[model samples]
Target: MADYTIRVYKNRDYNAVRMLFAEGMLEHIPATCAHVLKLPRAQFVLFISFITLLLISRSYLLSLVSLAIVFTLGRRLLTSEFHQYVESCQRDDLLDIEESYMASNNSCFWVAESNGRVVGMVGVVPRSSEVMLLRRLSVAKDKRHQGIANALCHKVIDFARQRSFKALTLETSMVQVASHKLYEKLGFQKTDVRVFPSLFGRFANFSVLTYEYKLRH
Candidate 1:
């Protein structure tokens, strides 16, 4: 068990939150790239493309080089998508805490402090009058699985219920199995899943899962 304090997010926590989110999300890229590449469709396409190159070039050396280049380019494209998401988060949310989350009274953000340092974060924003969207649940890499995530989750649940929100909901990627377990433990149900809509998303073919917690019932 880590000794920590959980409290409302402050302007000073911006850099830490951004850093944690980026590092955590980026850590998944290697797994994500391999996941994408291992798909039957992905492997088939790569194989077909390589064979075409071999026939055209008719040089075993050049064909192997071309195949390697394709693998590199494909991985780069998938990795860049993750980078772009982190950049978008920095631009939209981390740029100004007050204006983005704290501006509206219904929306609130919080952080967990361990040894006087920001080590975890979670936030709730209004999706509608009766519902709140729980977003960006992150804990420090070294400090995870020590109940910090559960504590932060309980804090947000209490906050939303106190505000009379009917339900709390969140979106997460399918690869985030750990997060899924945490949300499930907290009584959120898997309500929906959608394919990533971005161009890179189409190629990667991974889907996002949405979870919901009905406060009243």
Candidate 2:
């Protein structure tokens, strides 16, 4: 078994983390669709049917059906729009780090590594003197369920407490029930809904639920 470790991200780890993010997102697709389709096999069949129809039929009806299936699958597949959003989040995180560095305030990125390979990451930013924002929490599928996210959250909370921050906050989609439950178990409370402006202009109606956790020092 490979030994897993969690550490602060270094500049050299950037490429590895980006690769891991792509892999993690792809791994999450099936589970994301399963929540809607309620059956993995059925979803697979529908996906195949959509592709077949797209290749064979020029009928407006078939194209419409294909479009619907694509919409359904794309939501779960982490398509270009989703990837762009995640990239935007990463850029924001880096910007936060740069700003904090300039101001001489502490900010850091953390990653989970197994056998010297990056597998997961979490970005933490101080929102105010008393609050921290937790964003971009992700783990490779194979490394999940081993308490990687739990450990990462705990570490960030500890870091916040050490810095005397009063609370931590995060936003996640309502469709991500497993993540919602995880945050709840970690003592986070849902506080509001957050509207994420779409970069692709396609998923403009989507919103994410926000949660907060108070850290008692």
Candidate 3:
């Protein structure tokens, strides 16, 4: 088991939280790309592209090369999509954690520290008067599956219940298989599923899942 303590976010933990979130999100690119490739639409597009190249160049070698290029472009598109999310996060809530999460009773952010180093973090923000959105849940790659994520989740759950919130909601990418399990294990129900609105998302048929955990009063 990893030795760590969970507490409210502090100013000193800013850089660590930002780094962890970015790394965590970017780490999913490969998995996401793989998921994309498995989609029938994606496969059909690749097939069409390969066939077009084969006819145009009349060379199997050139067609194979073109197929490889298509794969590379798809991966790059997903990479750009993830990067854009990270940048938007940094520009918004993450830009000033204190202001975004610490200024009000309805919102809060917390981090898990092991030996004074931030190893995990999670935050909750007001979605409405009775609901809170759980955001920024991330654990260091090396420190994952040691109960760090579970602990962070419980921290948010406890906070929400104490605040009289009716429910806690969160969203995760379809490629995050482990996250889907974690949320399910914690009693969150799949409330909705929607395709991500982006060039890569549309092309790959990528989607995001929304989960909600209702607090029992």
Candidate 4:
């Protein structure tokens, strides 16, 4: 509903885009923590830790305090992983948007500008000759639900269609339920699900979901 414009990424928008991405990714920490806490393994570990501490100290107060500390540390561990992911992204394709996206004929990145501010962004790269991988779709927290994300997604979809790609594919973490709903609404179908391929993810049973939108030639 808010007024905005979508355009190709430029060098000046680098800092804004990177900051938006880091913030967007970090915002999922609470959801990730909740998902991790629901796992049977996490509960079992917490229970065992509490019991062990209680047996060693023979005091309910001390045991409860220790349990709280363990819970806090667990949350910190997840937070650290999220930070590391953000850093890795900064070092990767995000380090230079122009080279990583606009430099290629089949790959590009776009950002949504509202009142001269970068409010949303999305990118696409060829996965094969026929498939395009949609990546880095993010909208500023305060500017969401204003059709920014929807527009960005459509931009990629339109680009893929124009480029004669067969399908658009993307992967999102399990905790991103809202993102899943958005992708499904835009006609993407769930194709696969897999563990996150990290020690924390394995221990917490964290997973990622892949979705694909096929285009008609």
The candidate that achieves the highest lDDT relative to the unseen native structure: 4
Question: Which rank order by TM-score, best down to worst?
Answer: 4, 3, 1, 2
TM-score of each: 0.92, 0.71, 0.95, 0.98
Model 4 per-residue lDDT tens digits across residues 79-109: 9999999999999999988999998899999
- For residues 1-217, what per-residue lDDT tens digits would candidate 3 score against the true structure? 5599999888999999999999999999888877877888889999999999999999999999989988898778778889999999999999999999999988999999999889999999989999999999999998887999998999999999999999999999898889899999999999999988977777777889999999987
The deviation in Å at residue 41 for candidate 1 is 2.0
- Tens-place lDDT per residue, model 1, 111-210, is 9998878899988888999999998899988999789999988888888898999999999997888999999989999999998899867777889999
Minimal lDDT window, size 10, model 2:
95-104
Show model 4 residue runs off by greater than 4 Å. Answer: none
Residue 212 local lDDT, model 4: 99
- Clash count, predicted structure 1: 0
Best by TM-score: 4
Candidate 1 global lDDT: 0.88
- lDDT of model 3 at position 29: 84
Please say which candidate is ahead in lDDT: 2 or 4: 4
lDDT of 2 at 214: 92
TM-score of 2: 0.71
Clashing pairs in 2: none
